[model samples]
Target chain A: MDPDELEFLGEKSKIMIIPTFNKENIHLISGDLGPFRASLPSQVPLWVATLLKKQKRCKIIPPDWMNVEYLEALKEQEKQTSGFTRMPSDHYMVEAKLLLDCAPDDIPNADEVKVIIKDIWDMRMSKIRSSVTKLVKNSDFYAAVDNLTIMEINSVRPILPHALDNLFRMKHIEQPKPSQNSNVSSFLMSKRASTSFQLSNNEDY
Target chain B: MDLDDTNLEDLNDSNDSEDYVHITPAEVLELMEETWVNEKFAPEILPNKTEVVDIILEQIKSMEVNIKNLSNDDFTKNIYQLEVDKLRFMVTSYLRTRLEKIESYVVHILKEEEKRVEKGESKYLSEQEYKFAQDYSRSMDRYFNKIMNFCPNLTSDTWSSKVIEPNNNSFVFMKSKKTIEGLPIDITNADSDLVDIKSGSRVIICYSSIEELVKNGDVNLI
Candidate 1:
């Protein structure tokens, strides 16, 4: 799956926001949001919070783990550990990108927090890169990937999966067959065009 | 007065349809999401969730009606509209993914469907998709014969019999939904290697080793 698709799923997660206007409990198909009283914090879906912030109707309250001190400590612990550690949010990358992009001012020490998160992200990414290299070199049959979040897992996308697949296919060829006409379907081409168009549009956000 | 008196909760209680009497609309939405992700990541086509899609579409229509009752300037209208757009995109993407797979693997999937039908097993393709695959396969057969006519001297069973099939042996990232112990990944050795996957733990493994588990919802391809 694409990283944007992961972000789309991650946006379903709820976050706290302070609405500037009063409204009745907004009943959504997934669930109800709330009867918003001005200045009172209410938990809403991440997408909703971003939408409200974009409309200048709400102040986002950053999630607890998004703070500078917490992230710094977490970064230190991650450095100390040899294996992947659990992330505060399953889609931490998505949360950081969406929240920090729209409402940096709402988060105290936002710039510092952003830098620390990037530091942690880089640390974990390098660890993954080294592990992936080791995995492909040894041609291990399988590997446990317990604590890596979805976005981090996706970063190793086509390379890791394709390499492992090719290795397995090489080992398990059934029979030698003559070359045949295998043309790329035109249907897929058009579909891919539209999909990429949507991706580029979302990237602008 | 209608605006003040409207109660969205009432829609949840007044379910006249026996098809979805047991589960609430929210649960239906949740099931749709799970189905969408599972279908997206699985190496091959999965069983269609036609019932869930139908229910959600019905609910979307109902929601649209409710929204229409509100004035255009209502801020809540945009929120509701956003959700409807998301749901619409999800359903379209899910169905499109399946259709793409079907077209790509039409012959192989049809042959698999034949065996499943012979054994009285449930089918993976929906009724409309089956029709689509049949039509596509016929066209491919015609196209192949036309191509073979250009080279009539070839005497091999190569071009006539080859069909595109999904690589089941491909590696995929998966998260176990429950603790599944003693699962055999390899049985060639005298002391076979068994995997013990704790609930919520992720792994990168060959899809064929755990294809059945995935079908049974024990594990989800990330």
Candidate 2:
């Protein structure tokens, strides 16, 4: 397998599991976790390992259709523990999840996926930069931060240098053009001329 | 008390009568001699031309004294009073010299009158001519006093109207000159109130409102 393909398969093969300590009702779902694991970046495994270590007595099981309700409960618990109710608008979570549902053999080219992610990230960053510039100009930085949440999401694909450069350039903003009035200078000049005339006349006579 | 005496009774009766003692030219001449006894001076048997000039000069001096004393109070301590005093002095001096000349002329006229009377001439001056002379003298005296005392500065002509455009927002210029002593004073439009400017020893006054000056900023200098 290509190194990139092997990395993709290894990511998909990993699973995240949660356990209930009590044996009175044991619900489980076991499935091919490859695609789901592949959907997450390498950081998800570390999160899963930490969670499992923290709950040592609970069982860790594979998720399947038979235990869908249990999986949902686990997800709810994870959300509560992480204190994150929803993904931010600019996050690529939904798209990543959609990709996860596809079979590994049917996955889009890694480069193609990377391109899509970069395009989305670039677009999102551009919007944020514009909004930030406007807020700063208006002296409304606090309001802007209160209205929008900024977050970081990891991706298995690397962002292109050109796309990164474009996003960085967008941050360097320009001030709006001032309104033009051409006649004011002329009026002032004429006034000055008249004053000089008056002064000179006084000196002459 | 001596009424029993004939001469005293006659004197008392004469004094009580309607007819009073009259002074004749002979008596006047005799009295003049008595007044000038120690001196070789004779009272002019007839009034001389110089005597008339002296009389007029004395009258003018007395009038000036009266006017000066009347205006001595603090209430009269102002530029107007000073001007009045100056005018009075000028007129008095002028009139004194003028009256001297006039007296000589009058003396000549009186001599002619006497000659006409001797010749039994009548109607030397018509009634109208005499009245007109009297009125003219009175008017001259009154005007002399006024001119001497007040010295009022008045303009015989109106100021030229100035037209100004809206954009030309400048001050008005008022040219003032003293009448008695010619002194020029330039007053700008900004100084709208009455301004007293001293040129030499005389004061030139300029009076105008701020509005009028600003409005009439443009004036024909010529």
Candidate 3:
């Protein structure tokens, strides 16, 4: 599929409209939409819904996954699973966040949704952090776990590559060029200097 | 009678096959935002503006109706929603950019007026200018309040207070101009207070403290 199609799939949000004008079935590049009538809830692309909402023409309907009660239950399910639990939608978290930010009034219990999402994020991050540290300690660079979600893997990508590279360098210390080693040492020194500054500042607060 | 019929026929054809162009929210937002770049720096050079915002808003209204009857795969709908997010983001940013300009100018003026008052100057603003300033500030406040209400997460307290690890160390390379809060210092200085870092300087800063700075364009994560 084209990148446009891929991105379109990634961002769908559900919303409700109370239209003032009637329009027959309109053919769009993506698909067919509506014979719109007044006060009926129909699904539209999120962009259309948001635009309407901004104009006070429509109200957004929160998706089922956005409900605090549902999320809390899902979080419980996630907690019980040592393996990955299915999410309500592929992009529910991002979609819910966007809706909550843009049209909080349309989404019921938005503040609760935010809190629950954050709780889930924190739990996932903590798990990922521990696993990442363990991976580094074991120096199992080639190991790939099937359980990690794309988001989870991406969270560690920032530090993991560097950590693995460092491990590789340590294992093959015999043939290291002097100039390259110096360059890497200087970079490490700069990093150390910054950390020292941070350590000093920590005492003040 | 032939000419009148032809004209009537043309109108009917135009209405029957109204070619609706697909527009991404970003494109509409960018078109709306073009005027503000000049307005921020040179408000005087701005034209007697047309009410184009109303027109764009009307287009958005029509788009709402258009979306209602569509049945597409999940992907297309998501892409559409993403565009909406971008539209809202652009609108928020547009308002914020103007508000920033207004705030900085008003604050500078108010400060200058205060200094003048301290120096025993009688008048800061004339009656009309005073009224205009009051109205301007009120509108600025109103717009700001509206955005805060619309995006509750925009409030600093909502997001900023969640600092889990304050002392997590990270290196930061300064990107733009920033003044660190302290007296300038050299390495040989007996006191630690004299250090002043600038662009091209790499410093290890606590991750939590640098988070806001990185977001604000003052530093780059290294």
Highest lDDT model number: 1
TM-score of each: 0.86, 0.16, 0.38
Give one digit per residue, the lDDT tens place, for model 2 in A23-67. Answer: 121110111112223223221221232233343422233223113
RMSD of 3: 19.6
**What's the best-to-worst order under DockQ?**
1, 3, 2
* Candidate 3 C-alpha lDDT tens digits along A1-205: 1223223334544455555446665443234467677677777766566656776666777776788889999899879876556667655555665677788997787898898988877777787677778867986433333344334444564366446545544543544444422321111212212211111112223
The parts of candidate 3 lying over 4 Å away from their true place are: A1-9, A13-21, A25-28, A143-152, A168-205, B1-222
Off by over 4 Å in 2: A1-46, A49-110, A144-149, A152-205, B1-222
- TM-score of candidate 1 chain A against the true chain A: 0.84
> How high is the TM-score of chain A in each model?
0.84, 0.27, 0.66
TM-score of chain B of each: 0.84, 0.18, 0.31
Select the stronger candidate by DockQ from 1 and 2.
1
B1-222, model 1: which lDDT tens digit per residue?
A: 122112223333433433334566677777788788878767678877777777677767778888888898898899998998888988898999999888776777898999999999878898999999999888877777777777877533344354455756667888999998987654323465788989998998877788888877788888
TM-score: which is higher, 1 or 3? Answer: 1
Complex DockQ per candidate: 0.32, 0.00, 0.04
True contacts kept of each: 0.52, 0.00, 0.05
Cα lDDT tens digits, model 2, B107-197, are 3333455696799855233344334435554565565566655444522111111111111221112221221222112222233233332
Error of 2 at B18 (Å): 99
Model 2 misses residue A31 by how many Å? 20
